[model samples]
Target: MTLYYDETGDTKLPFESLSIAETVIQGTLRYLESPYDAEVNLLLTMNNEIREINQEHRNIDKATDVLSFPAIDFEVPGDFSDVSTFDLNPETKELILGDIVISKEKVLSQGDEYGHSPLREYAFLIVHSVLHLVGYDHMEEDEKETMERIQKAIMEYLKISR
Candidate 1:
């Protein structure tokens, strides 16, 4: 799997190290039980930058902790047990999973508000975003709970506590 990471937020705040972040992302993918090789981008951005992106892509006016733009439009059975059944990227020969945009400012503030370390919050968001990239949503109560359960399980797997 290829994880392309970028940052565009305040540089002063000590963000999660790239290696740790990559591990968390990879752990999330593994938690999904997917075996397909994939490529994804994780963008750590600022509030305003994310707000602009949210407006442009989702038509939402405010900045969110994370946003996912999936490359494909399909869902797999349960934690992606059948991920290999999905189509592959013709050129890359990898599953073009998608992109994840995270607001660093939100991460900082939410980490403080939620009484968790910024790194933990970052890991949580990465897992949440990956779930979305793999065709998970929270449009309903049941779906939301299911996604939350998976996210919590992944965070636990990463040993990131609240």
Candidate 2:
């Protein structure tokens, strides 16, 4: 798993704390623990750029915190009993996960609203986006709860307490 990340836009926003372009390529590879190669690319941009991206991809003009573009269309099993088990991609020996786009401006603003550090909020967004790349959705109440639980667990594991 290779996470390729890049960032664009102002680095000096009043509300912005940490504007970074981080790629968790090696960490993602280790987490997946599969012979398959999963590449996860992310572009963290400001609100204006994000708005353009959202319009181009999702046909929505509004800026969203995060957006995921998955390579595969398989649905994860409803049972969360085996969430630790990583999926494998047999063909290319790589899962070829997908891409994530986040808005730094959104993160900072949301952090203030949620009463948490910008780092914690950013971490949450990363975890949330990664989970989506791995086929997690929260359209339903139960699914939302499950996803939130998983996100919190990952955050705790990373020692990112709010």
Candidate 3:
């Protein structure tokens, strides 16, 4: 698995924290039966940066905790074998999963709001974003339940609890 981090304008966040996130992400991918040759880009930035991104891409003015931009389009709870057909990076020859942009401020704030540790929230967000990268969504009730179940299971598997 290949993981990339972009912190062009962030100051308060520790870039080293992403190493744990990468582990959680890889664990999730393995749990979901994704190919070993997978790549994902993670962006950790302030709320303003994420707000601008949310506005530009999703037409929302407020900052979201995380946003996933998937490279492969598939049905929710998709098959991993189909993932082999996704776009690959020319140099690395890895399946480009997609991008996950997370707001560092929201992670801290939401962790307090949700009564979970910052580490748990961070790992949860990484797992959630990985699901999105693998064509999982929770826009509806059933989909939300399924996604939540998988997320909780992955979190449990990683021994990352709230």
Total clashing pairs for each candidate: 0, 5, 0
Q: List candidate 1 segments past 4 Å from native.
A: 12-15, 77-86
Best by lDDT: 3
Candidate 3: lDDT of 30?
80
Clashing pairs in 1: none
Residue lDDT tens for model 3, 1-162? 788987645445434567887799889988887665788999988889999999999999998999999988866465766554437787888888899998888888888999987778888999999899888899999989999999999999999998
lDDT of 2: 0.67
Each model's lDDT comes to 0.80, 0.67, 0.84
lDDT of 1 by residue, 100-143 (tens): 99888888899999998888887888888888888888999988
- Candidate 3, residue 13: Cα displacement in angstroms equals 4.3
Clashing pairs in 3: none
> Candidate 3: misplaced stretches above 4 Å?
8-15, 84-86
Which one wins on TM-score? 3
Q: For every model shown, what is its TM-score relative to the native structure? A: 0.89, 0.75, 0.91
